[model samples]
Target: MIEKKSITFLYRTYKKHWPLLLLALFGSILESASMAGLAYLIKDVVDDVFVEKSYEKLIVITSVLIGIAVGKQVGFFLKNYLYPVVIYRALREMRAKIYNRILRAKPSVYRKETSGDIISRATTDVERFGEISSTIGTNIITETFTVIGIIGVLLYRDWKMFMIFAFTVPVLAFALQYFGEKRKKYSKRLQESFSQYIQHLNQIVSGIEVVKLFHEKVFFRYFNRINSDLFKRQKKNRFYETVYLSSVEIVAYIATAGIIFYGGIRIIKGEITAGDFFSFLGGVLILVNSLQTLQRGAINLKALTPVVERIKYVLNLPVEDDKGKDFKGLKESIRYKNVTVKIGESVLLKNINLKIKKGEKLGIVGATGSGKSTLVKILPALITEYTGEVLIDNVELRGYSVFSLREKVGMVSQEVFIFNDTLRNNLLIAKPDATDEELIQALKKAKADFVFRLENGLDTVLGEKGSRLSGGERQRISIARIFLKNPDIIIFDEATSALDVETEEYIMEEIGKYFKDKTALIITHRLKLLEITDRIVVMENGKIIEEGTKEELIKKKGVFYRFSVISSS
Candidate 1:
């Protein structure tokens, strides 16, 4: 049995296309009526042409048969053609909704769900659900109407013969229910296994460089394990599907045989004419074909249960909170009061009190996993779950709209992301209304004038992650976006770590000129970069160990002092 929730969702999804659906429904009725008409006319063909040998009636019968065929073809065309339009439109709507939901989902959701799982639900599972829905709209509805029409003809011709066919329905229904449940179980497992398989494949592709550097045998072994599990689940699912279809067919055949044996006896005894016997048999064959199609559709719908649940899970995920006033600009200092961040049982940031006046350039130095990134992420509303108050211009950070807050803050991180689009479009992401001259000026400020040398200049496609550009060039592109954005607050999270000595110095010179009189935070291990900052903070184990000017920290001989000494050596 299909769950009521799933049925409701599908109905809501399809109800929008009711106009086309009504047309398709009418076509199904016409097609089924034509089929029954064909069976009913078999009596005339046999009785007048064969039994009575009447030539005049033969012409009338042939003409009526051709008309029925034409009507049936028209009905087939309408139903078959229109349902795809409806289904495709519905599927497109579903895909768009899923993508929108994902875009609005909180950052925590991304951490909890793998990209593979998300991609599978958005793509593979949605396509599968669409397939099942198509089957229901086209095959199931049409077959159901066909069965009803044929049953009407069967009862009209001979009630007793119809009774024999009716006896097998209960048994067929039981088989359909049982096998359908079994198939649903295996289908859920199969889908899960496929998700893991896709996840592993995604990991391999994304980390192909690491995989090549590491032991190939280990990666291959893990991949083989996932692949084998996927194969096993798929095999089980197919097994149940095949058994369900075959069971329905067997029952249909047995019922047909019983009808034949009993009808033959009736004809021999003259209780029914040859025309009546043939016509009833024709109806039974049509009914049998219709039921088989209906059974296949039922099985497909059962498989849809898991797919629906997965899609609903994603659709129901909580979106990021976006209710607040628009942040215009920074007026005073930014302050963090006892802020702490935790992921499960592990603390990412300890209680920390900090303050940075407007236009202050603060440098943060820390080893990996020292909460430096997490601390900076809070200003942009990227990390929302913290146990303290963060104030911007004396107002609660959450008081400002996240969109407006992020617009005022610019971040250029170590892992720069470049979309597979033209350089012009990529730059336009920061300032959508920027003109050609504005972009060239921003690129020049970031020391990324290499764009002019490309074959297509700004129009040149950047390829995946700026594959066409070197590491230094990609970093420059990232900085150019910051220049275009012209945010009041700037963050450099190891932004130039990938650059060589000369490029780093040139890029740092430009950044220093740009950072003058702007609030800035720089997170880097390179001590030489600290020369541009008025003060520096050193963190360790999720806590701030020391903070002061470069000379002050060096005189104190603390974490920053040791770091600077090591870099100098």
Candidate 2:
């Protein structure tokens, strides 16, 4: 049995297609009614034609049978066609909503979920949820009506035989409930195992090079463990499903045998004609088949309980907070006062105080995991949960709408992500309405003039993740986006680290010229990149240990001086 909450969710998902649902129901009713008509007419054919050998009556009965067949075909066509239309349309809407929610969900949610687990919910779990609709359409509507019509015929032919068949209902119902619960338990385990299988596969694909270099045996062992688990869970799930169906079939067979035995006794006593007994048998067979289908549908619904819960989890994830005043342009300064950030027990950033005036270039350098990236990320509202305060133009950072605030900041990170599209299309993500000439100009500014040499120029299809482009070329493409955005503040989070020395020098020269009058924050380990900054902050273990102009820090012979000496050597 489906839980009450699952029923409510499915109703809300499918209620918009009620017109098609009603039409499908009408077709189901017609189809079942046609079956009953055929069974009822079986008596006429057996008695009038087979027994009486009346040619006229035989012709009339044949005509009526032909009409029933035609009606049944029409109903079959309507139910088959309309039910899919309703189901698939609802599924399409559900996929879109899931994607939208994932895109807008908070960063914390991403941390909590693996990409593989999320993908499993969106794809596999959703497809399984569709079984609920199938059960409703096929088992609930069609089979239920078919059982009722056939039972009506059975009662009319011989109420005593119908009574015999009725004795099996309580036993069948109990079996269905018991087996359905067992199937549901295995189904949940099967889905979880599948999720882990997907996650393991994703890890292997993403780290194929690492596996090839050092840990091939280790990764393979992990894969084998996950795969074996998945196989075992799937085997168990199938076993339970088969057992449930077999139990239902056994009960149906017993009921059929009981009816046959009682009907034979009645016919011998002359209580019913041969034609009447056979007609009742035909109705009983149809009813048994319908009940089996209804039981299968119920079991499928029970299996869908876990799938429904998984989908609901994704849809209910918290969306990013976007409610605040729209940020214009920064006029004065960006300041951090006693700011701290933590995730679980890990302190990513501690109480830090820093300030930079508009149009001033600031440099931040720290060892790995010293909170360099985390500090810069706070400016774009990507990490919003922090104590103390971040002020932009003397207003609280949260006071500005996250979207509007992001529009004013341009960040070029070391890990450049290039979509598998033409260079022109990839560049247009920064400024969607930019013209061809504007794109060419931005590429030139970022020293990414290689696009002009490609066979199709901007129309070239970059393979997945820009496979056709070299590291420097990909970095140039990212820089081109920043040039296109032309925001008030520019952030270089080791953005040129992937480029060759010559390419890095050239790109930095171009960037220096473009950002001369703009407020800028440069986060890099390379000491040379600090040449353009008016001031520098040195961080160690989530704290700002030193702050001064480049020359002043070098004069102090502190952490910055040590870093400078190491770079120079």
Candidate 3:
């Protein structure tokens, strides 16, 4: 069943290379025919050249052997040419498709999968698929046809000898049945072990600082455990492969011995000519070698099931739905009607009714895990699987395409993610066609003018996660993106949280002016940030418990008052 599945996958992935396939087919046929010709020529060499002792026949036989050699070489060249072409092209296409799927897939997919596993699937697993192409392409096609041609030659020489050789087929089949399953099982385990190994590596690299600061014993123990498990699985996999090879060798030697004994008896009795015996020997050698190759290929194809299944899992993930009415701009207001967000048994956002008019500056302040960020996330339709409706201009958020809605709404969060690329490229992600002058102006507005001091200016390449920039500088770059986009609605989720007091005050004062005309929602734990907003909502335990003007809330001495008092102190 796995063999059939592997074959089906190969056919589907590579069917477009039909022209190359045709050439490969033609070449394989020629190769097979040439192989048979070589066997037949052995008979002529013995009978006509040696026994007859004729110089004329000897020259003719020599010429014919040379011709067969040339044909076989030509066939070998053409037949093998397409294997790499099909393998590389098919894998390139597969990688491109998988990468596209990764980009378009919903955020939830990322939550359930590890970064290491995803990377391994895209790189290592795709490579395994490429191996399947080579294994099935060259081994199955050429070897099978060559075996068939040799069998024809053997039957022509002597049917009795051919029958003796054919008996080994069932024995080889039994060997494959038992050994193939074991190889498949071990191969799957090996791949999973590799994933875990990669995940451990990723965790250590991403958190290298934390690992360095903390006691080193815990990390070393964890790594040792993972490495040991990987080594054990790898050892088991190699053991099974050795077992498969050993079984194949035993079967091959026994088959060869039986054929030799039978053929020798017939030759001694003068039942068959020396020429006939030699030709049959040639044919049987080809057949046995082909059988060994076929066995190896079958084992490899079986092992590929785990890789194909892993790739299929990622490709089958539900991509984000982009088919909906186009969104132009926010006209009047955004409304949240009893919206609730849940994941498994945990509720992140409770039923809430709220509205923000066009050009309104709304502030949300709450302790951690109070759903402040979750509440704003719903307005942009990032968290789509909610209980009730989030409407913009009275149109349901789901009614608008994700791309168009996100295009009109921009968000800058506390955790700024900068690409390991140039400052210009990072800024261009917000507005691809923005000119240098426009970029500078936006950078100025966001108080990110530090770019001008760099030797390369906008061309300066940032390190991973913008490690080249300070925390305040990275936050400023993120703010620059928001300013460049100039979306109809802007949401800042503690964009100034990590900055020192001076930098935070500067960023807040600068970015505040940019939000004046746009409908904005700001989430911050710092109560001082709310002074710039017209209205503020205080949340606790996924529900909005207090809402009013900042002054009004302070006068009420409620949750907002308590938050303000705690933050100031």
Model 2 segments more than 4 A misplaced: 172-206, 215-250, 303-305
Error of 1 at 284 (Å): 1.2
Q: What is the clash count of model 2? A: 0
> In candidate 1, what residue range of length 10 has the lowest lDDT sum?
498-507
TM-scores of all models?
0.91, 0.91, 0.90
Instruction: Estimate the TM-score for candidate 3.
Output: 0.90
| lDDT (10s digit) by residue, model 2, range 1-569 | 67888888889999999999999888888899998998898888887899999999988999999999999998888787788788999999999999999988887788778997998899978888886787788667898888888888988988887787788888988887788789889998998999888777887788777767895777778888888999999999999999988988888778778877887888899998888988987887787677767876877776677888999998887998788888888899999999999987889899999999999999999889999989999998888779999999889998998889889998999888888887778989999999999999888988887888999998888779898898888888899999999998989999988877777777888888887789999998787778988999999999999999999999999999999988878
lDDT of each: 0.89, 0.87, 0.86
**Better structure of 2 and 3 per lDDT:** 2
lDDT (tens digit, per residue) of candidate 1 on 320-390 = 77789898878898999999999878899999889999999999998898999999999998888898999
Candidate 3: list runs displaced more than 4 Å. Answer: 2-11, 111-121, 176-202, 221-243, 303-310
Off by over 4 Å in 1: 172-250
The number of clashing residue pairs in each candidate reads 0, 0, 0
Q: Distance (Å) between predicted and true CA of 485, model 2?
A: 0.5
Please give the distance, in angstroms, between residue 166's alpha carbon in candidate 1 and its true position after superposition.
Answer: 1.5
Candidate 3 per-residue C-alpha lDDT over 1-569 given as tens digits, one digit per residue, 9 for 90 to 100: 47566567767888998898788777788888899899978998998878889999999888888899999988888888877787798888998999998988887677678987888788978888888768777787889898888888999999998898788879977886688678778978998888888888898888898889999898889889888888999999999988987887788778888878988899899988889988988887787778778877877776687888888887777799888989998889999999898876889889988989999999998889999888998767777768898889999998999999899999999889899999999999999999999899989877787889999999999988798889888988999999899899999999888777776777778777766788999999887788789999889899989999999999999988987988899
Instruction: For candidate 2, report its TM-score.
Output: 0.91
